[model samples]
Target: MIMCREATKLMSLKLDRPLTRREQLQLRLHTLMCSACRRCESQFELLHGLGDKLPDTDDTSSRS
Candidate 1:
């Protein structure tokens, strides 16, 4: 079973890139058995979704 530390790392990495099948399975299993991690995973997804809807902050071109 993946520990909380590794599980959390995987969770963060998931936001940045696609996880491998093994990593996805491990995180899924960990979240299933750990309620705290499950909640965290939900929160991470929520934040990621919200971030996607936010406007980009790159205004350097506009400044000129």
Candidate 2:
């Protein structure tokens, strides 16, 4: 069984890249048994989606 720490790490990495089949399976299993991790995963997805829709504001070139 995957620990909450490792599961959380996988959840964050999922935002940046795709997980392997084994990784996906492990995370799925952990979330299935752990409600807290399940909720954390949902929050991570929501935050990541919000980030994608926001416009980039780091325009240093616009400054003098």
Q: Highest TM-score among the candidates is held by which one?
A: 2
Model 2 segments beyond 4 Å from truth?
59-64
lDDT of 1 by residue, 1-64 (tens): 9999999999999999999999999999999899999999889999999999999897887795
Q: How do the predictions measure up, each by TM-score?
A: 0.83, 0.89
- lDDT (0 to 1) per candidate: 0.95, 0.97
lDDT, residue 61, model 2: 75
- How big is the RMSD of model 1? 2.3
| Deviation of model 2 at 9, angstroms | 0.4
Tell me the deviation in Å of residue 21 in model 2.
0.6
Pairs of residues clashing in candidate 2: none
Highest lDDT scorer: 2
Model 2 misses residue 29 by how many Å? 0.4
lDDT assessment of candidate 1 = 0.95
